[model samples]
Target: MSQATKRKHVVKEALGDFVTPTEKQQIVKVTGSRGNNLHEAVTARGVTFLVSMPPKFRKNLWIKRGDYVIVDPIDEGEKVKAEISFILYKDNIQYLQKQQLWPEGFTVEPDKEPEKAEETEKDEDFSGSDDDESDLFVNTNRCNYQYSESGEEDSQEEAS
Candidate 1:
């Protein structure tokens, strides 16, 4: 088959309905890429190992650190303990969690990031400041006054 056709098939498979892992398959979080098709991943049980990405997913789908993937164990290789079978998206992750198929060790901490950002923004409001002027210009030099809208320079001393 042509490369384009193969890529289409791969994308279709990835975007299709979420597939539950079989008995021998398990979900793992990618830790790092080891160049080529090899990736370092850690299982829910805290085991770290290498997994190989299938050729179809090489250019079609990109996997990165913190992404979850379903891996099928291999009986032959020592270093590459498994092969990546499926990549998991947020929707797929939610579906698996609802089904109670997700691993307990993998906490959904990413969802809390937005909340933390909101809290930081609230803290940066500077509502308690004593000065009536805006805090943004508090540290700027006051001598550099711009010309007024009438195109006339201000009375403040201009820098040489």
Candidate 2:
């Protein structure tokens, strides 16, 4: 099978326990590229955020400007930033929209500045410590995608 086909199959098998987004995780639209795995995005409420792509997504998913993505904010009192958790594929976005589960009022107006209050709100939404941030989602990068026909046990175990 091709790499993309394998990835899709694995993603389907692994997403059995897909967790829905909480209030903290907001859907944002990529406004511009910031280079080095970072992109400028605007939240549904028009909050401009600096979104960074985690190495896992950078390697596995293709993200581009104007694409809608899920972002989890990482605020440390100095500057506001977010890590891209899920890249919204067209089908995923369509499903969310069809179910009316999409974040309300999502827009990507250009050259918009995030207000101070909005920035503070975003900061407050990120109450967890830095360590907790990494635990929010399962890291699929460590999964073994290759299948063995013999059904033999391997030295390493995949996370279920």
Maximum-lDDT candidate: 1
- Lowest summed lDDT across 10 adjacent residues in model 1 is found at 151-160
Off by over 4 Å in 1: 111-160
For each candidate in turn, the TM-score is 0.72, 0.53
The residue pairs found clashing in candidate 2 are none
Q: What overall lDDT goes with each candidate model?
A: 0.89, 0.70
Using TM-score as the measure, the top candidate is 1
Tens-digit lDDT string for candidate 1 (1-160) = 9999999889998988789999999999999999989999999889999999998799999999989999999999999999999999998998999899999878655667789999888776756545666545554555766555652344343532
What does candidate 2's lDDT look like per residue over 1-160, in tens digits? 7678767764563343233467888788998888888888987777787888876555556678788887787977234488878777657776777777777675223224367567777787876435566556666789757676663454334422
Each model's backbone clash number: 0, 0
Stretches off by above 4 angstroms in model 2 are 1-19, 107-160
